[model samples]
Target chain A: MISPIGWFIIWLGILFDILGTIGLVRFPDVYNRLQASTKCVTLGTFGIMVGIFLLKGFSPMGIKALICGAFLLLTSPVAAHALMKGSLHFGTKMWKGSVVDKYGEDKLGGEQIEKEG
Target chain B: MRYVLYFIIGFCLWLLLTLSVNLDHLIVGVVVVLLGTVLFGGYFTDKPIKFLQIHRLFWFIVYIPVFIWYMFQANIDVAYRALHPERPIKPGIVKIKTTLKTNIAKVFLANSITLTPGTMTCEIDGDYLYIHWIWVQSELVDKASEIIASRFEKWLRRIFE
Candidate 1:
């Protein structure tokens, strides 16, 4: 059974998860959704992993949870960056409310090599 | 020496992951790390000794708490905007430059910006990092970079460089 503190942390993680999902659905554009889903989901999952570690203590399960959390932190931003770079290169328009487009301005109206990566 | 360092790091990672001090586990970990070091260690940093520097390790330990603090603040800020009816956001892309010479340092800087609230790194081109800002308070490149990357850069420079 999970301790009270562990349960609290788990609930916090679930709350973040819900907020991130709401952000994902309600955001106007792809980039905004990426920001919400990527950052929030990474933190939410990492929090859940931390909760699991606290519940299990220093045993194998807890150690595994920590490792999973570390990997999540390392990889989520990479995925987000890749998605954003692809979308921008393919000319996905920013929302009308967006204030500026520096990337578009500098690299504007130019064809990019598809297999650049 | 680099290979030895790689082997030791790999062994330590295995110990942490497996969390077992049994004799059999030790034997298997050593064998696996030996193979891994042989196959992949060459790609690791040329100056693996830098990893052993006391200041770097100390700063890294110190950085963890600061990062977590910023992350908490970011979540609160984003959560507020998400729950707000008008979504009081002034989203835009902005270009900022990092003074950190090392690519690894720049990578960490980019990752930190993305992980934090109000900013997401869209691209890194040499010294320049293009960011998607949730709230565009500053339009100037120097000002934006200062706001976005300077906090982490101060610590990362000492640790990585």
Candidate 2:
């Protein structure tokens, strides 16, 4: 039987996933929405994986869950990084309130506009 | 030596999670894992051994559980903000200065910050990290910088410095 904690985690995961979707919809810009989606969804997925592991015990299915969790953890951030880098490279403008543009005087000395791929 | 490390990590992880001691399963696992490691070794043969320091790997293992705890804590905070009716999100970007000098440590810190809920690493400029935080918990941007540097950077330095 799944423990109370496992059920709680599952519910929390669902709650967080829904919240992330809401943030994605409500956020004003691409960067903000990306932040909401990537961070919340990753944690939500992780919580669900942990709950599944607890419910399934140490069976092969649990092992598979762990593997999936690890993969998700490793790839999600990398994918987000790639997306951000690509956006920046493509000259996507930040929200007006953005405080800093550290890349404005980039050392690479590339052109103001990224070369079209 | 690299293959040996890979084999041991794979075997131990398998054993610990499976908690199995059957000789047949052990043999099969070892053979399959070892073969995989051999095939994988080709991908890293050009990289120097010093780059993947064994002692650093040990520290990384020691730090993972602590990192997970921090992640869980961040997850709860994000979930709370997300579920609250007020939505209480400031939705701003903050520049946090980092002390990690090496590229590896900087990459680790950037990835770690991005992985944690509610914060995203927007840009890594030398020792500065431009982060987009969903909720501005601290008024002082330095406070967030200190929090990340002290919590994850120290451990990452131990692993990679």
Candidate 3:
């Protein structure tokens, strides 16, 4: 049987995941959605995995959960970065309410080179 | 030395995966690890090994818990923003310059930023990292750096310096 603390942590993770899904629907743009999803997967899923590891102790299954958590930690951001890069490249407009856009400025210079050539 | 380090890592991974104590498993692990080290050990630069100094390793050990604490804080922060009806988020991409010189260190910083509160590294062009922040507190680079990475940058510097 899982400890109450373990169950609580798992519930928190689920709550974070559900919030992320809500952010996916509520956010104004791709970038915002990416932020929400990345954080959710990284924290929520890893939290649940850690809870499982705690519940299972040091058995092979427990160790596997730890390894999987590490893998998720390492990979999720890279995946988010790739998605963000792709979105930027495809010119998915930033939310109008965004306060700044250094990416736009950088891309403007790149565009000038494209126009000249 | 690098080859030995690779062999040790490979063997440890083998042990972890198999969770075995048999002599046969040990021998097979050694053989496979040796082959793996021979084949791919050259890919690991000396930089990582240099950062593996005892002092640096200690700081890295210390860094993990702090990182986890911040990660939890970040989750709550994001969760609050997501769940609130108003969404209370002012998103933007801000440029921040990192003094970290090594590619591996910069990569670590970028990954750390992505995992930390309210910031996701969008792109890195040299020392300048473009970060997508869920809450746009400041457009100034120094202030943004302070807000986003002051806690992590100091510790990471000690580890990677």
Candidate 4:
């Protein structure tokens, strides 16, 4: 059985996950949706995993949860970055509420990135 | 040197995975870790060792709580915007300069920015990082880096640079 504190954390993570889904549905454009979902889900899953680790203590399963959480933390940002880069190169339009676009302004676009990529 | 680090990491991971105390586990883990390290350790850089120095390690330990607090704030920031009736947001892609020199440090800086409130790195080009921000607080590059990267950049510089 999960302690009350662990339960609370798990619930909090669930709430964040739901909110991220809401953001995915509600946000205006691909970039907005991508970032909103990525960050929230990363933190959400991490929180839940840590909560599970708390609930399970020193069990092998518990340690795996911690390892999985660390992997998520390390990988999700790279995924977000790659997606964002792909979206930009694909020329996905930014939302109208956007104030600026430094990416489009000075970037040499696909060629330079691929050479270094 | 990198193999040594890999061996230690793999051995610890094996111990955690088994959660056991046995000579057999130890022998198997050592053999497996050694073989694994020999095969893959060449891929990793020895440069990260500088990051493991005493003062830098101390900064890393101190940095964790700070990072978690910012991450918590970032989540709350997202929730507030997502839940608000108007979805108050001023999205933009802005350019910012990072003073940190190393690729690893810049990567850490970029990841930290993504996890922090309202900013995600779109591209990293040399000293400049283009960021997608939920709120465009300042259009000026200097001011923007000050806002977006300064907090974590300071700590990252201490640890990695």
Grade the docking of candidate 4. medium
Q: Candidate 3 — which residues are off by over 4 angstroms?
A: A110-117, B22-40
**lDDT measured at residue B9 in model 2 versus the true structure, 0 to 100:** 71
**TM-score of model 4, chain A?**
0.88
By descending TM-score, how would the candidates be arranged? 1, 4, 3, 2
Give TM-scores for every candidate, taking all chains together and pairing residue i with residue i. 0.90, 0.71, 0.88, 0.89
A7-116 per-residue lDDT for model 3 (tens digits): 78888889888988887888878888998889876889988988888888899988888888888988998999999988888777777677778877876442111111
CAPRI class of candidate 3: medium
Per-residue lDDT of model 4, residues A2-116, tens digit only: 6777878888999999998998888888888887798789889999999999998878888999999988988999999999999898777787777788788787442221211
Off by over 4 Å in 1: A110-117, B21-39
Worst 10 residues of 2 chain A by lDDT: A107-116
* Ten contiguous residues with the weakest lDDT in model 4 chain A: A108-117
Error of 2 at B154 (Å): 2.2
- Model 4 TM-score on a 0 to 1 scale: 0.89
Query: Which is better, 1 or 4, measured by TM-score?
Result: 1
lDDT of 2 at A55: 87
Worst 10 residues of 3 chain A by lDDT: A108-117
Largest TM-score belongs to which candidate?
1
**DockQ, 0 to 1 scale, candidate 3:** 0.68
Summing lDDT over every window of 10 consecutive residues in candidate 4 chain B, give the lowest-scoring window: B43-52
